[model samples]
Target: MSSSQPSPSKSAAQGPGSPIADAAPLSLSAREPHVPADRLVAEMVPPPRFDSVRFDTYIPDPKQPSQPEAVRVLSAFAAGLGSAPSAGKRRWFGKKAPAKATGPRGVYLDGGYGVGKTHLLASLWHATPAEPQLKAFGTFVELTNLVGALGFQQTVATLSGHRLLCIDEFELDDPGDTVLVSSLLSRLVESGVALAATSNTLPGKLGEGRFAAADFLREIQGLSAHFRPLRIDGEDYRHRGLPEAPPPYTDEQVTRAAHATAGASLDAFPELLDHLAKVHPSRYGALTDDLRAVCLTGVAPVPDQSTALRLVVLADRLYDREVPVLASGVPFDRLFSDEMLNGGYRKKYFRAISRLTALARDAKGLVAQ
Candidate 1:
């Protein structure tokens, strides 16, 4: 939800006199959210959309046996956490004892987008017996950003107290992330912090096409050792039986709808991109605070890889918040260029397109004929 204050005239116009004026639309571009370090750590729980999701609420596709099996395995994994030795569990000499991990201590859900991996990951987080503070959940980007904000040792001190750490959309995009996350997780595991993750790529294959992964095989392999890869095979559930996304609306239509809809945000796509660059990706969630819908005009293809990646993070935050997106100009499928779409980050781009399309569909009801 954007915190951008509405213009005085716009606010006055939307004042209590008229029903349409009772609620003012927001502008995403106008907000520059600054999140503090402690807030970031406190907000690591599952996004609101998944706040209440548990294993029982997950509806697995009958066609995909792997789907149901993922649920079963994850359920058992969460249960096992209750019995695992605590971080301070020690040997007779007052030294720490190695985790009695019968097998891989963590589980990795590897699947394409919309395969309910996130749902399962959140479910596991909720099912864990520890208090909310003892279990942490966040995206891979947020995890890395936490390290950036809190420093490696401080982040470990913070999260090492947790009994479980659930990472969604886990990825290793570069050698730096490869080394950072590998070292971080290794320390956490030694502290007896249980780990679980979900991603399109398997643990071993992470950063494959995106970078010279072979150069970091040792680090990558060390990271992989922390998790038991659980294969989840299924179609993207977002488009499984849904109709095609509605076509773009006219700018006038978008603007008009933004005025009529309470808490909706209106912005030109290009301006929004520029704004996102100024705000850290870690603050994207705060940037969308209280937003009902996102309305964009003059939507066009992203200019370059950096901009596209930033938009992907924004798209993810919006999707996580379940904020509808109403837009004019280009459709989401055309947001990325062919070269970018076919490049190493294709999976990320595709996921963004899928998520944005779903949000677009969610916003169709906000438009008027």
Candidate 2:
């Protein structure tokens, strides 16, 4: 397809730096159909009317620029852009423009998953219309695969022209990921781009076990020099979607599960279940209200690694300055039938739920679905 007509001025003897001029026209041949350079460019850069953009453009508060917390964050983020040596060098603050960050603002917003982590940064992009910039969305995984070869360079060019950079779901699940984040972020910061990211782990918490976490932490800590850390405390905004998740649980399942284990002692489990509920209230509420959906019944024991780790911590709390006594709660059911999971001080995180349930029998009370 043909590109948008060049501006009248641009149509004149084209300058060397013009993107159109730089691209050689396609050479069509009998053997193959020529794809337009403009088409290729179109695919690489998102349009203005994208779903993310439309969703992000609402200023939660427009007066004095404070409609939403994201707007406030954007204002703070924008102010930091002013002090950035690299951002200042571009002098983009005066004009609505996007530029690469040889210098980038690496601010990470870490918190529990599904806590509107992505939405908060998204709101910043939508609210910062005064500073027009290219906004792209990518998770840690997507970035990892693209940080090398042509991917990183092209992404830079596409995003650089814009003054602000927004990244979402910045999880660091692997060691190699931490190292690359450091190298790339260092480059972006040097280029002078203002970056805002959302994650479920604190910058200090990232790559906790990985070799590169130290470097990642060192690089990110410098963010104190620019973007300020703002903890967003709020309810999960996710369930507010047009089509919300199904109701947490069915009535019959709850009653039946409750009736099935009326007299069971909940003494086997302790605060183990409580903490997960505390830190992840909605998830926990959903879990308890609908644990059967994931296949569960009554008070089960903590089996496998995930529940086991939780179990050990609970055991410590219950037995704090006291004797070792069985606590109670619904854990995984797989532990009872699985001989492999029968005995062990070490908690294997990935154990079967069934095993955990068999162990839950020690509880003083049993809960229904």
Candidate 3:
């Protein structure tokens, strides 16, 4: 027994006859598997504005009166989206039965600034299925840009593939945009695309005195009829510690900014300004329409007065549109120096700081962590 080596295992004794010995070696293939063209295209599409916003991260502030209602409405909306028909079913059954003939299911969230309207909208967008062709998220400004590029019927045809279309910064300031959006909303709903939108204005009050009140009403009335209005009233979460001051920018500034930015290039802010300056009298409000969110990277102190002024205008435009900004490389408070803030544009610079701080805070809320 002392001299005996450990008995060879059965497989060792069996040698090549063992199951383990006969098995093929595992190896990675040189070529990757093919991805479908549609899948590739889906991957290439720009992500939704609130791609990171999800239900799990949304904490309804227990202290806010409107938080409960917002939570309930968001839950209902998410459930509705999740339970909506799949692409195959939507194509076959939705058309044959025509769901929208009875009226499409829609929700309109009306709330004050920084009350988490965008957060809720982003959450709804994220809750929808990952089929890029079946969902879209953008502001009304971006919608108009699509229409301008693709034309009305083509835009409708393109967006028709989506089961849901979510619009943020919903406003009826521009008569032309109002008409186009109202018509587009109706057509989309009729095509079985559901709508979810957030706005500061009530449906009835949209474009009240700016356009022919009756005409404006007529255009959006049907569109508004489709939605169950849910009011989200809460403190401006962005301005918690700030002193109470009147909004520096007026409704006229907002409308003008929207109109100016509507036609500007959706490329970059500088390019947008260049394009707008060519066509419009002033480029101050030009980037508002297409500027959904702002990200300031390598944000050294603004180098020159011209650059500082441009940034002030950009902040104003962004603030008026209720678009959130994110800054890195420097604190937003340090974006402009004492020299810049002490100039003739001091008040404007101060207002920019105030508004941008709020927008940045709101943007922070949008991040899941």
**Candidate maximizing lDDT:** 1
- What is the per-residue lDDT of model 2 for residues 230-329, given as tens digits with 9 covering 90 to 100? 4444332332232331222233443333334311111112333444433321122112210111212234544444455444332222211122122223
How do the predictions measure up, each by TM-score? 0.90, 0.40, 0.54
Q: For model 1, name the residue pairs that clash.
A: 1-288, 1-289, 1-290, 1-291, 14-21
Give residue 163's error in model 3 in angstroms.
1.1
Scanning candidate 3 in windows of ten residues, the lowest lDDT window is 23-32
Which portions of model 1 show Cα errors greater than 4 Å? 1-4, 7-24, 89-99, 202-219
What candidate 3 gets wrong by more than 4 Å, as runs, is: 1-49, 84-95, 98-104, 202-219, 241-355, 359-369
TM-score of candidate 2 relative to the true fold:
0.40
Per-candidate total of colliding backbone pairs: 5, 66, 0
- Kindly list the per-residue Cα lDDT of model 1 for residues 1-369, writing each as its tens digit: 345584545555555343446555778888878888999999999998899999999988889898899889999999988875565445324776764677877877766678898999999999998899899999989999999999999998898878999988767456678678878888888778898877675323443452222222344567666677777777789999999999999999999999988677889999999988898999999988877889999999999999999999999999999999999999999999999877768778988999999999999999876
lDDT of 2 at 96: 35
For 1-369, candidate 3 gives per-residue lDDT tens digits of 011123433544554333323222211111112333233224322233345767667666667676667777677676676555634346655455334434437777765556677778777776766465677776555566667656888777777767778787565445767777988888877666778876554323333432222332454777756776666665555566564432223223333332232121112233333433333112233324334444433445666666665566556456656676544445566767887766544544554666777776655532333
When sorted by lDDT, best at the front, the candidate numbers are 1, 3, 2
- Candidate 1 overall lDDT versus native: 0.83
What overall lDDT goes with each candidate model? 0.83, 0.38, 0.54
For residue 56, model 1's alpha carbon misses the true position, in angstroms, by: 1.4
